[model samples]
Target: MNAIADEAIYSFGIDIGGTFTDVILHRGSDGQSISTKVLTTHLDPREGAIIGVRQLLEQWPIPPRQVGRVVHATTLFTNALIERKGVPTALVTTAGFADSLEIGTERKFDLYDINIEKPAPLVPRELRFEVEERLNARGEVVTALSQETLAAVVARLVEQRIESVAVVFLHSYLNPVHERLAAEYIRKHAPGVHVTTSYDVAPEIREYERTSTTTACAFVKPLAEGYLRGLQNNLRELNIGAPMFLMLSNGGLTHLEEVLKNPIQMLESGPAAGALSSAFFGKLDGYPDLLGFDMGGTTAKLCLVEQGAPMLAYAFEAGRTKRFMEGSGLPIKISTVELIEIGAGGGSIARANSLGLLNVGPDSAGSEPGPVCYGRGGDQPTVTDANLQLGYLNPDFFAGGSMQIDAPLAGHAIGRLADQLGLSLVKAASGIHILVSEAMASAARVHIAEHGRDPRHYSLLLTGGGGPVHGYCVGRKLGVKRLICPPSPGVASAWGLLVAPVKIDRVRTLQTTVQDGDLQAVEQSFLELEQEARGVVQESAVQHQKTFVKRLAEGRYKGQGFSLIVPVPDAALGNEQGRQALIEAFENEYRRKFSRAPSNLKIELVAIRLSVHTEDLIEEGLQFPSRSGALAAVKQVRKAWFEETGGYVDTTVYNRDLLGSGDTFNGPALVEDAGSTLVVGPNATCSVTAHGSIIIELH
Candidate 1:
């Protein structure tokens, strides 16, 4: 097939991770591209963003004025919460429940830990005040709100000079009237303070989860709002008039205004973008079932994609006391892609435990000190240092040689670890790599099993900085037959931002079994949610853009503790046959998830959900010009550690920018690119695809 560059419409995507800021420029003509990664400016991530953007434009010879809309994603909000650096906020809860945030259902993640610590409550107990109000599950007021008590609570909040407040009442999800009125009074009395209500934030049944979600929204609202506003102003200053949209953890884009009111929805935004990109690429390549593997500088994220869609979870725990524990941190009841993440990225620090066992990280050196190989004052060994010592990376050519790696230092770092472990340096380095791969594969297995799926059935699509470098070994460990690394694996998250759909998610709580037969109420709730979604998508629309809305429901069998999400078509919800059809779909989904549905029980619909989306398709005719002939191996052959071989073996190194489609290479080889490197281990072979990607098949 001839190269197709004509469809390249120039667009940009920016993703700011914990350790780096990645920028990508996609040229419409021939799919010519530019990608860059800059050290994150933790003081102000925007500084690194600007630098990355400029570097990409300069490298591609593209002027900033001609650029189209820039899709941006970031982990800033997530990091702020995890690091406990968010704004100080207060809480105003229903009477006798001022300690809701602190109590947290009294569930300990570690059942028997003598000294296990829970994440500290975001709002101090002193700042949390009790207000008199009560609502039953049926949305009936059991006790009238005491105005004097509310006023007194407001007086206390004012005295404390609280900057933000969260209003969570008993059973407010069933009836939001009390919450609405309290919010209004707070705004009127405590002028200049931010307020969020559980009904508006997360209209779910669980009081603890709903209250925590609302509190987090209030806690981060000021910081996220101010940061986004600053970013918007910076973009406007650069003459980038295109509508600014922030990527959501749900794999959609939301307006800046919406996010300012609900910043909790932005957690996992950066990693979610990478998962979306991998799913999008999988669809384009006709792979329906695949694994989206994204490894950046600080963490590796793995998500399962089935039928071209990523799995969604309604609740997620952040800043957990235990890594994989169910109830350790703040709970957010929001729609988000289900993914497993671990501290196994390139910069994961290598250390000796107190017991003298070698351990890789849950902590990282980050971009500042980086790895010992980076020669940036990092004396500690890291995953990058391991890769460098094993000869998987080219020291002088790392990051296109813009930054050189200190091989001698890497050797020294591994050497120390080896001495401690009673092993040779190469064995220690390779062991670290193998251990990391096993950790990733193990996590992926657990995540897949949780969803009632087998991990062995899916293909692994590896992306991000360390993913491709270590993908082969990881894939082998997981029994994956094929691994695909795209043209720019390191910047996959940036690519995902550009390809995401403009959308909004709206939901309404309607907790009732079919015996209540409130079908009309159900339909009405969906209609209201649809209207809210339409308003959001309409604002996101551009000229001539068509809009589409879809309906869904959170449902379960009566008496079931949990629910399964099922899509509801408008046609079905609009008519009797359609309603029955949706019921069948729900039953099938329940069976798929739980082996079987209880035929004796009625179906309970928990929430009416809807999403209005406007799809922006990338032009189809874009193609990059072909580089003629097979890529020549530029560097002399070297002995690199191959874990499978149990020793150092001869390996070949080639420049990726010069590689032509259809060229083939074997394992124990390195394909070096400007932005990242692809390592092919022993017993594997890679072929350059028509799209300039390296497809590796394991034996």
Candidate 2:
């Protein structure tokens, strides 16, 4: 293998998930990513990444030297926070605000509960130290930061053996001088300790969440940087000399240098890939509003895509003790690709509850000791066991038979669960599948409703290792009519990396009111935002690109504590009429959200946002000859359980690679591939597309 050249080309996109590492290779000439998957090496995720890349290279007969850019998405940051595996860290704040994490928003989400525990602070109270400093909301400093107090805090941190420190001062979002000075003083005294500032990292309102976000950034900075550096070195050693780009939770890519400073931005990186895939493929299916459904080994993720773009969120909570409960986790405000996740995947463990009713997971038998069917020393019953016992899986053909599964183990696990629940083995397996499907449907419903949407109105784009197997049941429960399972669905997320546009979102808080007639202030904010966003995109190293800007204001009627986001005109700040038009747009959006506009209420603006984008849009889906025949005529048949039918049905099974366009088949079918499976049940019809995808229409 030699280093890749400018003229030659294979590009790679790698997604390192909890259970698997998927690799997609693009042929330089066609720019089509070839996909494949490998079991994750939890001990060293990079090992699986390399193996997956090598496997794809071998199959395609492409030299390593031909490979160009490598886009990567990893769960390292998320895992570190979840497992508490990052380096020793401490927090420094204003004299009176040292307990920001402890004295959070102060509003209990579960107000009626007698005992509701809040999420534990990431940095312990003992390690939190404060310096005498105060900054007003308008960037005015009342008490200057003192060097003597900073030195004492550094001395104590050294004594406590803290390797990383985060500084967050009161109202620092408006004036960062105190936080920056404190960081410099600490760096001078504790030369080896990493220093992070809330002003530099988050610079937002909400003292507790801002501090937590900065602390988390510092907490995982060292670990993520080391891992990324190692991965880059390994790629260089393999002669794949393309610059590596990391996927952000916001569905954008950033260079390794930028990612190292803010690893928390990559929290939802892996799941974002799947959402991108759904959005990209759904467009080709003539569906602009699609609900992405991804069910893998450990969890089921749902994301909404409207007009071929996935929704974005500015606030996210991670490491929740209670999965669906708000305020059960630490809040970190940043631009994130919106998604809803549940514990309802193939490896989700199933067990009997105290009430004697069977329940499916929020817990999973992950990769190492996977489903009992994997014959990997796992004894617990999981969704995989239910699928296998119900004959949804072909024992020897799972993962293209890369690892043989033990049917006896699957049967035993399901049977044991059945015995405890006083049900037949078949009934218990079907029950598990239904329970999991309902859980998924319910989660999607809540997520969609939160955005004031109806699930039944959107088309479902299903992908992942387990999505196809349960998509129909989940869709049925949600009352969704159509399900689209694209080709190579298992590696769909990796493919998504190829289609994502270079995007940058910039936001700054600018509290003002239209009544104030301070248009220059708004203009200045947009100017600053534009410069900042352009700087980030330039840092990404994508050259010779055009920039498009979308100006938006977070506005609300007077007296409202929070603001609703409204898009403003790009030309608004330049003239008076443009400002009037922008205000009208705001009112229109407000009316849409609230269903009416208050006649006499004043309006206030809280924040201004600008997003820049550059994309090489390509036509989707290559047309191929359609196959005309019953799907069963071209593939094998297997038995799969149907909850609605209350019995097993003989289901036609086809290999995704072999299915061609225009091939149609009725429900009670399974489509198999190396990476995943698609299960179509009774009352459904599946038709193959020219690009080798399956469109399942539900009745």
Candidate 3:
């Protein structure tokens, strides 16, 4: 394949993580890129973006107008939901059906626990108003919507003074006639208030998921829209004329208009960006299957990527009161990259429990006061503090030495917790390290197991500030043989946004028996939906120059509650032979997933989902230095603890900037750069790749 480059297009990517705000500026002409990381301003996330952009400008003198594209991904919306900071929302649904959000399937994910907890509904009972409306399973109106019912609902909404309203009627996915009427009336009467409908957010089969998705969109609409608009205005004020875009949870980049209509799509976009980076960079070296790991300040995420594509899931829980408990969180229906997240990171607090056992965390010190070593008024010991106490982190060179770590303060905090556990300082620090690593490994096991995957078959792709620090130990525990560390690991998420495609996802419910249904009509349905999706692409200014359309449908046994995606060929529905091929394809996929297909059950097609993507974004000819195994790269030798050795070892510290392609080094060693530090275990060997990445082969 030939390389493609937009010689005139210069792009900038911005990603705001809990601990850092990363910015990257790239010139398409030469494939040269420079990135910078600044401390995140949590009080106002926008301020962090501004500060990072300015810092990068100081280092690379590029005019703002010359930058053609600006893409951003952040954790702001997800944090808002977790912190219970959303706009006042009201739910308007079919009469007597307002409880679906609260009565989700009534199946406890944890059957034996008596004190199971679920997230409270976004809209309370007093704010949920019902109207007379009904639709059959066939999209036919059973009880026609009345003008009086709309009038009464609108009156109640105005009286409540709610900031946003979610309208979801019974069988709305099959037919949205009543929902449309209610929304139209609300917009006219309750002007200036945000309105979202179930069919617009999630047009699916399940009522509980559809209603919850609609409510979540409403809950965050006001907050996300206001923040985005204000940020755009600020960019304009700074004379940056580039078209700005936002990242979506599905690992695509879309304009602000689409995200404003459905804010729930951006909830997990931050982690999705990091996963995309591994998929994109891993392919450059011919690795197809990867265990993408990103450990930041407050959380660690692991995703499975096969052949440069991340696995996508349609449903997941958010804001779980219990960590890793499925049913305890709010169910959201949106296309998102499948990743498992745990509260194990650099900022995870370390303390002795009442039983005198040391626990790493489900809590974090965050970036406000930060870890004890940050010397930002944090009194509690965190993973970072423990790492510092163990000499894995350099007190004189933390954050490129811009912020000096308080080594003494960090010791005092860890020492205090060590006394409670009746252990020495070194043992206490090592216990914290092992405990957090085990937690990450356990989460990865569960995530890989759910997909019937073996962790031994995948190589760990590490990114984020804390990723390289913990990757070696975690991969060893999982019995993985290899780990790859990329350049600027902490800013990899921002880098992912630079190479992401502009995509839009669309869905239509078509519950029918494939054998009995008219195949031509099914083929015709995809074309119609493709047209609608094209309308959205047309509105985007950055993409649609060259586009691609993929078609897939969800299929299941007649009585099943779940479904699997089956690819439908372009010519599959036009003829009898092609139609049989379609059935065979579905059956093969079903058997592969479940190991068997029921002989007595018939097959049913549930829905058709379409994805429209812009032309694949390509970046090639990124120049790197030739191979060199020179001794000048080594900066110093410091005494660092190696748990495998049972004590401290003299570790060689290397300056990453001085390392070249094909360079090889033996551990234990520290590879330090401005953005992050890579720790090589004594049992592993590190080699620099042609792409300027370090590959560690663990024995």
Candidate 4:
């Protein structure tokens, strides 16, 4: 491979998704970027990323040695937990609490159904061992840990050949003495096994969530370690001497070492990157409030971004038995960018149900046997096949002509479904397309409503491989007046990693009534959290820069079960003015969420959160190459389906790369690029911005 100048410096961002691996190589000096996508190797995800990286380096003729930093995000850890492919693990909890995971707050996701199933615990009762340990809610030891019992438990674990163990004790979040002692003994006796402690993973009050999160970390620890180490060694073999960083589920980048300790923090890493991409690109194009819509092969994710920041939630569920049901999954207590995911994507299988109604998926044909249109041995018809039948995708120009697709194969598969539904080909295909879009739109509506936001007020920012292909219909369903499709929408998540800031989030649970709380102690606690968070962020930073810290607290009425998060002032809370400010902040947030605050209830503080980060690395803004030349001609005219046209109509097709800034086109058109395609419906006006993004305004 050819090499660029020795002085040139570059950064690499790789995102491995369910169906594709996206790689972007960015030149730091001038903000130039080149990206590519390749089918993910399910057997080994790293192999696909390495292949994509090699292709970009060779195609751009840039030396691997000049690459300054490498940032990556993947769904491997989450997939391992969902598929139950991780190492055999065991949970160790306080005596008499071995069935806590099974009991699970005794709540049912479906209350009315007589036959309801909850997700099984990761650790079976046979493997779960308990020890004599007790700590009160005030962090006072009620009963000291019994060394004899713990020793016996350790021996059983080693004898059973367990690969990993989780040490969890009641009230460990308040005082981790027993948990730490147990972990130390286990590590000393079983040197070959991995250990995860609830205190270290999640220092929160919820026992079920903490135990679940800890066991999850233990289950995926060995796999993540091996994968990360193998990837580092592979990069070195390719002569890319760069520091590696990982994107977290909270839309921040951290060093690999931090991630190895708590791999559960990366549960939503890939989708978080897509949300950040929407915020970044949306803000650049003069829109701050937006609804991020990312549709890939297996799933579609929707997140809300307001004022250039995505919403964040402190807890998330994984591997849900019911895709839309909230409590049908494992609870993980990690801070994550709030997102609503629906099983509506390009690869979602479509079929006729027993009741003679058409049904799309909550299941998908992943990259292994992708969509039928790819000719990859898939016989079931998918949304991609329906789109291909509807003329939304160009067979000859798909994936920039890098991968050839068979339209006839897609037609045959979709035709079978049409025959089952007793509908014409065009109507059947359109029904599938519209069905998936409606699913996404319906989910987005509920998500937005929950956040107290209106769909019409927010512009829809579309990304991912399938996002642009179906964005027009999805946007119209939500009543959005505008849609923003950024450059290289297919690989936008990878690009998001490059532009993300080094960030860390830290939290501690401190239960106290606000009216009688120790204000000085709370202030001291915030300082300590800030110090810890800053240390981590500093370790991830390459150079010294201005650091920013945000303080937030979760509070609720004294007798309530849950709390609401509110921003805390930067001033000292010991004084009357500061105390009053804190009270008002909670009241205002409470009113905003519930329409009113309780008149006679005292507010109790539950947790304090700190967010630390360095300024964005790209302050000068991303600059796209100025396409100042004359507007190029349309590539071809093809028959494309549109409801307004009543059938397939001869539509204008333009090469995206050939369209310059200020080029305007009225739709019943297709704009084809290497990574994805933008289908513009009739009466919609499309314009190319100076940043090379397509802005579509609908009537």
- Residue 622, model 4, lDDT: 67
Shift in Å, residue 621, candidate 4 = 5.1
Q: Write the per-residue lDDT of candidate 2 for residues 1-699, one digit (tens) a residue.
A: 212233435668899877778898877566465677787888888889989887887788866766667889988789898788888889998898878888888878787887988888888889889888888889899888977888898999988889888898998887788887888888888888988888777877778889989988888988887889999888888778777888888887777777777788888998988898898888876788999999888889999999998998888998887788898898987888999998778889999999999989888888888899888889999998888888787878788778788999789989999999999999899899899999999999999999999988988988888898888889999999899998788888887776666667777777777655587788888888888877877766345555577777877888987778877865656577767777788889878887988878767887777887656323332233444445434467766778777777777777666666677878778778888878888889888766666888898
Q: Provide the lDDT at 372 for model 2.
A: 92
Estimated TM-score per prediction?
Answer: 0.94, 0.95, 0.97, 0.97
What lDDT score is found at residue 652 in candidate 1? 82
Candidate 3, residues 147-242: lDDT per residue as tens digits?
Answer: 887789888888878899999988889878788888888999999889999999999988888898889889999999999988888777767866
Worst 10 residues of 1 by lDDT: 1-10
What digit string (tens of lDDT, one per residue) describes model 4 on residues 1-699?
Answer: 111232337889999998889999888788888889899999999999999989988888877778978899999998999999989999999999999999998888999988898988899999999999899999899999999999999999999999999999999888999989999999999998999999889999888988889999999999999999899888999999787889999999898889988888988999999999999889888898999999999899999999998999989999998877989999999889999998888889999999888999978997879999899999999998998888889898888888889989999988999899999888889989999999999999999988788999999988999999999999999999999999899999998898788888998999888887888788899999999998888778756567899999998999899889999986688777778899999999898888989878888999899899866666364678766432464888889998777799888988887788788888888888888888889979988888888899999
Off by over 4 Å in 3: 1-5, 538-545, 621-630
User: How much lDDT does each candidate structure score?
Assistant: 0.81, 0.81, 0.85, 0.89
Q: How would you order the candidates by TM-score, starting with the best?
A: 4, 3, 2, 1
User: Which scores higher on lDDT, 1 or 2?
Assistant: 2
TM-score of 3: 0.97
In order of listing, the candidates' clash counts read 14, 0, 0, 0
In model 2, state the lDDT of residue 66: 69
* lDDT score at residue 639, model 3, on the 0-100 scale: 85
Off by over 4 Å in 1: 1-9, 60-63, 114-116, 569-571, 619-622, 632-636
